[model samples]
Target chain A: MKTKLIITTGAALLFAAGVLANAQRDAIVASLASQAGVSSFNADAGRAMFLGNFTGGKEATPSCTSCHTNNPQAQGRTRVGKVIEPMAVSRNPERFTDPEKVEKWFRRNCTSVLGRECTAEEKGNFLAFMISQ
Target chain B: MKKLTTLVSAAALTVASLPALGASPWMVENNTTKSECSDCHMAYAPGFLPERSWLAIMNNLSDHFGEDASLGDAARQEISNYLVAVAPKELRGVSSIAVPLRITDLRWFRGEHGSRLRNRAENNPNIGTMSNCTGCHRGAERGFFDDD
Candidate 1:
């Protein structure tokens, strides 16, 4: 009976941790939505943005998939052969938890890949897609 | 008298071997420099380049080798200071006026890594670029590059 009780408590704690992580992500997404002047983000649009190709940026990196790969759950490689961690929140729980880091990457990568800063709406959609993954 | 002679010879030999022991490993001691500089590539030892080279690189991080590696002002300043403080005043075979940006362009580096090795690195997917020192020198991050 004691072992069963411990297991149940462990599961509950894990669930609570998951909820807390999601809450943080939700707050960040909410703020992004407010900035974007939208009520919700679209995961399909995010996925399309992740896979779309463009010629605005450097010839080497035309799309997010150029480095991040198509599967968000899989590991990615940088242009210089560095290994990037999986982007999926399920695979890497720490992702999208820090708003500063999230914004930093967006500011740099959007300019690099799309040759411009990503819109607040686009950022929200991308985060929503990654969170869903 | 023989004992004294042997001791004197041993001391002389030790003194002679000091220069032959070579320079100490170029380990990055600063936490901020290590973490910030190593985000994209291996954090190269500052000893490989001159202070001016580091200054040039740090000043133009927005176009760091064709990548937008711009950092926050605080981090940028901290890393730049650390690098300049540790970098060599000058390197051999490089002109005083020249500010070499790539370590691979150094004379010592070219002597160590010839075209054959360069081709191998370029051809191999596992070792995509010659800049990826840790690809062959597994202990590069720890300042040990002798394994290769």
Candidate 2:
């Protein structure tokens, strides 16, 4: 009887945590969509952007995959060998929770990989893809 | 009498050289500085450079070593203050006019790491760059770097 009660409580807590994380992600995605004047974000489009190679950016970093790796679920390494946490929402629950951090990385990485700031639509799509992962 | 004097002098020399044999440890104390600066690289010990160098580095975060590492105003100010507070007043062989941006550029660093060791770091895939201090010094995060 005690074991059952403990398990039920643990499961409830886990579900609550998941719901909170999802709510945070939804808010961020919604803000991006409003900025882009879009109804919805496409995860497929985001995946393409993540994998696509571009000529405009620095030669060393042609795609997001150059540093983030093709698999968003796996850990990536920086050019200088620093370990980047997994980008998948499932793998890293804290990914993209902060507005400031999301904006900062997008501004820096988009400039490095795409030679420009990511459009609001692109940012939304990227988040959608990671969420799906 | 001559033998006794020589032995005493040798013991004194060993005592004096003890401090020189071990490198001083420098740990990051500020939580903001540790987390923010360590996002891309290790939050390097502020003592590695002087006050002017820290100020210069903090002022140019947007183009930090060719990457845009710009921080919000509040974070930038906090980190800058912490770094300046703990950095050494003077470093050996560094001139007052010099504002070194890279720790590797310091004369002491160059003397400590020779070309042969540098070549190995460049060539080895496991240790891609010399900036990855933990690649060789396993205890780098804990403020230890004596291991060679």
Candidate 3:
């Protein structure tokens, strides 16, 4: 009985922690949405960003989902093996505040993923999705 | 007996140089001591690109704009060899699975090329001809385009 109780308690704690983390993510996403002047991240937009093919002529290659999984929870890396964090409202504080690096990565990754420069609206929507996380 | 052994070894060596199709180039690079086509077009998987398209991109690495990415002649040749060996038979964009996708489906990319593509008036521009993806994506490298 004692062992069972212990297991139950542990599971409860883990569940609670998960909820807390999700709440935090929600709050962060809320903040980002306001900044981008959008109310929320559209699931369709995220899907498009994640799954869309590059439309340019430079190369015939992979889509965004090729590395960073369609969702942020599905963390991925570069074809060169660089580690990428989840694109959602990252619990990792480093992601949100690093505007300079954030922009830089968006620029580089957009090219690598899309084989072209992403537009401002696309970037904004992508941010909306990440924030929605 | 020595000749037989040598023949077996040569066969193995030739097979060893082959790049895996339809897999992530990054992870593949980690396992092999050999440099791969992924080292340059770091974003797109081998299967996504037709062999000829890969060759075109690889051949022009030095002129890769956005950042003007450059590759040595040797890397170019080796990558070219790998891609040609693996290029797809069917041209892309013809079927549902065709890559370098059209704008109707890819919302993010559509928005990226939206203005220019829209300006064309008919919304009939071939996604391949617009050059929008290349303006910033910096193809021939192994990753996606970013603003940073």
Question: Interface RMSD (C-alpha) of each candidate?
Answer: 1.3, 1.8, 10.9
Candidate 2's C-alpha runs over 4 A off are A55-59, B1-25
The alpha-carbon RMSD values of the candidates against the true structure, listed in the order shown, are 7.9, 9.5, 15.2
RMSD of candidate 1 to the truth, in angstroms, is 7.9
Model 3 misplaced stretches (Cα beyond 4 Å):
A1-43, A57-61, B1-148
Docking class of 2: acceptable
Highest-DockQ candidate: 1
**Pairs clashing within candidate 1:** none
TM-score for the second chain in candidate 3?
0.40
Cα shift from native, residue A93, model 2 (Å): 2.6
Evaluate residue B38 in candidate 1 and report its C-alpha lDDT on the 0 to 100 scale.
81
Measured against the native two-chain assembly using Cα atoms, what DockQ does each of the candidate structures obtain, in the order listed? Answer: 0.48, 0.39, 0.02
Query: How high a TM-score does candidate 1 get?
Result: 0.85
Q: Point to the candidate with the largest lDDT.
A: 2
lDDT of 3 by residue, B49-101 (tens): 55555656665654453322444456557656655655564553445344432
Higher-ranked by lDDT: 1 or 2: 2
The weakest ten consecutive residues by lDDT in model 3 chain A span A91-100
Q: What's the lDDT for residue B7 in model 1?
A: 100
